[model samples]
Target: MANNPFKYGTIVQEPYFTDRKEELATIKESLNSANHLILISPRRFGKTSLILKAVHATKRPYIFINVQRAVSTADLAELIVKETLKRYPLERIKSFLKHFRIIPTISINPITNGIDVTFNPGVDSNILLEDALGLLEMVSTKKERLIAVFDEFQEILTLEKGIDKKLRAIMQEQSLVNYVFLGSQESMMTSIFEKVKSPFYHFGQLMHLKKIPFEDFHQYVQEGLSAVTTESNDLAKRILNITGCHPDYIQQLAASVWDLLNYKKLDREADAVDTAMTQLIAVHDLDFERLWTGFTKNERRILRDLATLGKLSSKDGYATSTTYSTASRMLKAGYLIKTETYEIEDPFFKNWLLTRLS
Candidate 1:
């Protein structure tokens, strides 16, 4: 059997990457114009993959950092420096570090042959962070324009009070590099970039990423599945409907369906879809259970109501202020999303909850 034609849970490259022609063009144009970009999207919307593709299309060297991975200001500083070093040699970065007051202890990891950087304990990491940004700007000036992407940049708010100010200050002075800030949390990202009182207000061109259109996504999935299944068109529509064209889940569900049709010898397309959905829920059963248990009694009630009602509102047994508050909190935490009305984000989770409740 041919290998699965779908991919998820990591950066997807060409052939596997679906249509984002317009978004890809816009990002390349922004990069070429040296405009800093702020891209906002909910989780699993393919923001990272789209940005990386644009950067690669422009053939520019990039430093990509997942801000969520950093636990503290110091860790963030080290991450920036380490990514910079990966793209350049230590000899080149040494001169830039000399200008800063706080010099980090840099060593080579014998196992990975990668650089490991650390600062002394009790050092003011905010200062170290500032110096690190300054160093990046300095190094970028010596070469072609660099693209520095900070994924989940809203986490900076939790790292330090003034870190946003420090970042904006450094970014304003940077001329040779194009900065791309990606965020998953809509409210926090808006608070950082859109609000007037925030340090990054009017800092860059803001772009809100949305889900792939159903038609385009359906075509991609259809083409991929045609390699293995004779019923590609019907199966493609089922996958899109199941995933709501969510980039990550679409690929994930399609992969499962492909495995069933190719390896399991499933002759009926409907059975493949049903079997894939069942398998997906079983695989994520533990995660869903943990999430369900983590919620308060009120939150779980709201989840059940949203799944049953299809679109939740105060008229649908949510008359109390406490219940509304619980739904609001769930929305903020990304458990629910609002379109025409509020609904659960994960379709499989909703399916599991419905089965359990029934």
Candidate 2:
């Protein structure tokens, strides 16, 4: 059987990556100019994939740091230094360490052939972090500016109290490095970058990534489905209709549909989508159940209404303002997305809720 023509749950490269022509051009321009960037998007919206694709096109030394992996300021610093070493050699970094107030203990790891950096316990982690970042700027030359991207950058607020101010201070002085901050949480990211009182106010060019436009994604899905089935257009529309053009969901549903057609050795069937949706929900039933149990009574009521009734109202002991408030919370939490109307973000979750209501 031909390999599945769809990919999801990971960074998608060319052939699998859908259209982002305008976004790619904008990011490439920003990187080429060495401008710091703040990219905000909802979860699983292909933020990482898009950023990595653009960064690779530059053909310059770059470091990717996911702020979520960082435990503390020191850990954040260590992560940055390690990524830097992977690109540059140790001999060059040692010269820059001599200027640090609290020098980190650096050693080479034999297993991975990579550098390991450690900071002393109880020392000022902020200083260690500053030095680590400075090393990047220091080592970079005018011709080769380094690109550093921090994913889940909103988590930095939880790391150190004044780290934002400290980061802004350090980033402002570096001219030879481009800093890119990416966050999945829109509210927190907005506060960090848009708020005047926040240290990152007007710090970089802000870019908000929305779902791939329907026309662009439709072509991509149809092309992939057409490889195996002749009824590709109808199947593509059905998948997009269910997924609302969600990038990750499109890949997942397409994968299932492909497997059902290829492995089951059946011709294209009308019920293929229904069967695939059922299988997808069955695979994620536990996660959906856990998510359902976490909601308050009113919250669950709201979700059930959206899932089954397709609309919610103020009646049935749920106040009008309360319903609005709950939905706004869900939208912000990534449970629902606002289109012409508020709907469950995950199509499979909506399907799962339908089963419960039935």
Candidate 3:
């Protein structure tokens, strides 16, 4: 089989996962106990993938809803209803919809060869929440726990009006379902989950999804490549050195390298891996550009500083110009990461910015 290890911008499954056993176990334990969870992580750290993997492993009727683009209560409700219906038979879905008082005008078209159901909220629009809750309750009453995973949940706060409060109330009253709130934007997630004044505060256990340990990831890369007869520890280390164990980046680089070495001799030279990493970045230039466009000037400056200084805080305070308040904000925003002695985040972007700025 061809070595196709890359899964950039997609969910990672079990066989493709590198490390994260402990974190996965924690999520499983929480689900087993019927406890809700909030997963917060920096972007591209595999938060979505991990949750998807958990959902697949749970062996339960679960609904994964991406609320990133959901700007209204109706959109969220519709998405949940649609995903729920997708998991069951049409008759069961119609029955469930009836219980929710969501009277979808059902019709069949000869061209489509499927039933079309359109919902109209009518006067009592707030009943949507009630109906959604009722549907979940019914699903739960079926002796199976329903898990609703809200990805990019921070977007809920972006709703025009006070929808967050309504969502909080609905989620609080949901006795039959478990909620998993996943957010890649750390600042938004923490504000929603950690701030006492926020409606979602203390609603669930807070969990952060971090990068897999370097050694374990290296092992996985080697083994995955070995399956296609193009394995090399040096290639794995070089990829890690550039991607810094970022799961998506690692997969992308590995995929590029695998394709490059298809039925050919492995590049054993020290600089060969570096060349491959460069090519990977060049091939995915548009992705990196889009990522860079999301950052503010200060955030970009912080990244450049890290790339140049090779660290955030040093004994001599080399990058000391970045004030404590700014650092804290950046850290909260996931633009910066702080360790006991070192501080850095998004190693790939840092390198890219540094190179561009220089």
* Model number with the top lDDT: 2
Model 1 is weakest, by summed lDDT over 10 consecutive residues, at 310-319
Estimate the TM-score for candidate 3: 0.83
- Tens digit per residue, CA lDDT, model 1, 1-358: 4778999988898888988999998888888886799999878788999998888887777899999999899999999999999988789989998887889989999999888988897898878888988877788853578889999999988887888898888789879889999998877898899999999997889999988899999999999888777889999999888776678889989998988887856657668887899888999899999999998867877898888777554654556787767777787799986555777889889888988888
Ranking by lDDT: 2, 1, 3
The TM-scores of all predictions, comma-separated, are: 0.91, 0.93, 0.83
The CA-based lDDT of model 2 is what?
0.88
**CA lDDT of every candidate:** 0.86, 0.88, 0.72
**Model 3: residues with Cα > 4 Å off, grouped in runs:** 99-102, 106-117, 121-125, 227-231, 263-270, 283-301, 313-348, 353-358
Kindly give the number of clashing pairs for every candidate: 0, 0, 0
Put the candidates in TM-score order, highest first: 2, 1, 3
Off by over 4 Å in 1: 265-267, 286-290, 293-298, 320-325, 339-341, 356-358
**lDDT of model 2 at position 126:** 77
Model 2 Cα lDDT, one tens digit per residue, 265-325 = 4554666788899888999999999999999999998898888777876668878999999
Q: Model 3 — which ten-residue stretch has the worst lDDT?
A: 311-320
lDDT of 3 by residue, 1-358 (tens): 5547666767777678767889989999988775799998778788988888888888988888899756666666666766676666667766777666556565665897654444675534457656765676676643678888999998877764667777788778777788899997777788889989888889988898777899999998877666544447877887887776777778877776766666454455444455666665576578768977877766555565577776544334435565556677877766676544334665555666666777
